[model samples]
Target: MRSFVRVAERGSLSSVAREYGVGQSTITRHVAELEQALGVTLLNRTTRRITLTAEGARYLDDTRTILRLVDEAADGVRSATDRLTGTVRISCTAALGVRHVADILFAFQDRHPGVCVDFRLSDVQIDLVREGVDVAIRLGALSDSSMQRKQIGASRRILVASKEYLDRHGRPDEPGALARHAIIRMSNVSGSDRLVLHRANAEPSILPVGDRLLVDHGLAARRAIMMGRGIAPTHLWLVNDLLEAGIVEQVLPDYSPEPVPLSILFVPGRARVKRVRALIDALHGALRALPGMT
Candidate 1:
C-alpha cells in the first residue's frame, strides 16, 4: 500500500524509490503486484507525468481513505506527543496572506518544528476538496457544502480615498453623490451586480458602479486609491497600513456595508490532525490583534 501510494503521489518510480530507500525496479514490481491483486491498471507509465485511468481515479480516493485510517490508528496509540509531520495546503487571498497570514504561518512553523505548510495565494474562489486544499482562509460569506467555518476576524467593505484626493475633490456628502466622481472597481469579485450602499441616517442607494477603471489585483487597487485616482470599496485589512500612514482615509462611514466574517474553512473526511488545528489557532491569535476583531 505504501509503495503503491508513494508512486502514484510522486508520479515517478525513481523519485519514490529514492525517498523510500528502495531500488526503482522494486517499487515498479510492488506497484505491478498491487495492480494485479486489485485487478486494475492503476498507472500509465510516462516520462513526464502520469494520468490516472477511470478505475484508478475511483480507487485513489478509497486508497487515500484506507491509508488515513491506518495512519490515524497508529498515531492514536502513539498520541499527539509523537509530533505531527506532512503538509497542509491553504488557499487564501494574496493581499491578506502577505499582510497577515504569512506571519502567523511563520509562527506556526517555528512552534511545530515538524509540520510544513503550502500556502497557495490567489484571488480565485475555489473548492478546497477538489483543489486538494486542507484549509482555506476565506473572505466574504461562504455558501458551499460539506465544510465547517470558524471566524477569526470581521471586516466591512468600506469606501476609501487618499487625503490628497479628498482635499482636491472634496468628500461626497452622500452615496447618490458618487455619480459625479470616479471609482475603482475590483475585477476580483465573483458576482458582478452593482454595489448596494446603506446609510445610517438615510435611505439605501444601489449604485450601478461601472467600470471606469478595472484592477485585477487588490494591491493595484490600493495603489490607484493612493494615487488619488478614485474611491474604492475595499477590505479594511488591505488598507490598514495606508489608513495609518494618512495615504488613505475612510469615506462614507455611515453607508459602509455590513461587516463580512473572515473564516478558516476545512473540508470534511480528512483527519483534523493536531497540526492543522495548531495552525488555525495561530491564525486566530494573529487576527485578534487587528482592530475590528479585537
Candidate 2:
C-alpha cells in the first residue's frame, strides 16, 4: 500500500523504488499484486508518465485514510509510554515565530530532549503535506477547513502611538479623526490604504489613513511607531510592554480593529502524531499564558 501510494504520488515507479532502496521490479510486482487482488487497473503506464484510472483515484483516497488511521493507532500506543521521540516540522509566521513561538519551542525541547524540532518561519502559508510540515501556527481567520485546528488565543488589534507622537499631533477621539493624522501603515496587515475600526453596538467605520511609513513586517511597524513615526493598529501583545511603560498609548480608545484569532493548524491525518500533539499542547499552554489572552 505504501509503495503504491508513493508511486501514485511520484508518478514514477523507478523513483519510488529508488526511494525505498529496492529494485523497480519489486515495486512493479507489488502494484501488480494489488491490481490483481482488486481486479482493477490502477494505473496507465507510458514510457513518459503514469496516470491513475478513475478507480485508482478513488482507491488512493481510501488508501490514504487507512494509512493515516493505522499510523494514528500506532502513535496512540506509543504515546502511552509518556515519551516522545521524533523530529517535528513546524511552520509559522516570521515575527511571531521569532518573538514568541521560538521560546516556547525551546522550552518544549528542554522538556522532551528526545524530540527534535525543525522550524520554518515565513510570512506566507505553505502546503502542509507537500512541505512535510507537521504543524503550523497561524493568525487571523483560517480558510482551509480540511485541516485540523485549535484556537489557542485571540489577538486584539489596538490603535496606538508613541506618547511623544500623540502629545505632538493630539490624539484622535473618533475613528474618522484619524484621517488627519500621520499613519504608519503595516502593509501586511491589510491590503488597502484604509483602516477598518469597529465599535460595540455600532456599524464598523472605514477611515482613510495617511501612509507616512509603510512596512511589511509587524516588528518593523512597531519600531516605526516607537520612534514616533505615526499612529497604527497593532496586536496588543506585540506592544504590551510599551503600553505598560507609558512609551505608547492607545488612540481612539473607543474603537478597535476586529480581534484576530491565533490557531495551531495541522493536516488532519497527522494531528494524532505524538510529537505533534506534544508541540500543540505546549503552544496552547504558552499562548494562553501570554498577557491579554483569556
Candidate 3:
C-alpha cells in the first residue's frame, strides 16, 4: 500500500522507483501485481499523463485511510504520532495554494516535523494519478459524474464593487440591473454554466451577462474588482478579507447566488487512508468552524 501510494503520489513510475533505488520496470511490475490483486486497473497510462480510472480513483481514497491506520498503529508501538511522519503531496490552484492552503500546510508541517509536505500550486487542472498528487483542493461546483469530494470550505459567488466604484455608479438594486453595469467575471469548466441570483424569499433569477474583463483566475478577477475597474461576479472566499476591510461592498445582496461552492477532490481510496483522513478531517473541522456555514 505504501509503495502504491508513493507511486500514485509521485505520478511517474520512474520517479518513484528512482526514489526507492529501483528501476522503472520494477515499479511497473509492483503496480501491476497490486492491480491484479485488487482486480482493478488503477492507472490509464499515456505518454503525456497517467489518468485514474473510476475504480482507481475510488481505490486511492480508501488506500489513504488504510495507510494512515497502519502508520498510526506503528506509531503506537512508541509515540502517539501527533507528528504524522510522512510526506504529503498536495496540489491546488496557484492563488489559494499560496495564500490559504500553504499557510495551513506549513503550520501542519511545523507542528509535525516528522512529516514533510510536497505541494504544487497551479491554476490548471491535474490528473491525480498521473501527477501523483494525494489531494487536490478544487474550487466551485462538482461535475455531473463520479469523483469523491469533501467540503474543505463553502464558497459562493457574490457581486462586488470597490467603494469608489459603488459610490460613483451606485450599487445594483437587483440582478436585472446588472445588465447596465460593467462586470469582471470568471467563466471556466469548474464554474457555473449560468449565473443564478437569489433573494431571501423569492426564486432566484438566471442572468446572461457579458463581461468587460473576463478572467479564468479568481485572484486576478478579485484584484481588478478591488481596484474599482469594474464590478465583478466573484468567489466569496477569495474576497472575504477585502469585503471585511470595507474595501469592497457586496452589491445585489437580495439577489445573492444560489449554491455554487468550493470542495476538495481526490480519488476515493485516498480519502479512506489515515494521513489523508487526518488532513480531510482537519479541513472539515476547520471549515465547519467557520461562520455562516449551512
Best by TM-score: 1
TM-score of each: 0.79, 0.75, 0.71
Quick one: RMSD of model 1?
4.5
Per-residue accuracy of model 3 over 45-135 as CA lDDT, tens digit each: 9997676789887888788788667755755553553446666678788766755777777676666676667888888778776566768
Candidate ordering by lDDT (highest first): 2, 1, 3
Ranking by TM-score: 1, 2, 3
Residue 152 displacement (Å), model 2: 2.3
Predictions in order: lDDT: 0.78, 0.84, 0.72
Candidate 3 Cα lDDT to native: 0.72
How much is 96 displaced in model 1, in angstroms?
Answer: 1.2
* TM-score quality measure for candidate 3: 0.71
Alpha-carbon shift of residue 231 in model 1 (angstroms): 0.5
Model 2 lDDT per residue over 49-77, tens place: 99899999999989988977776676777
Report the poorest 10 consecutive residues by lDDT, candidate 3: 285-294
- Cand. 2 TM to true fold: 0.75
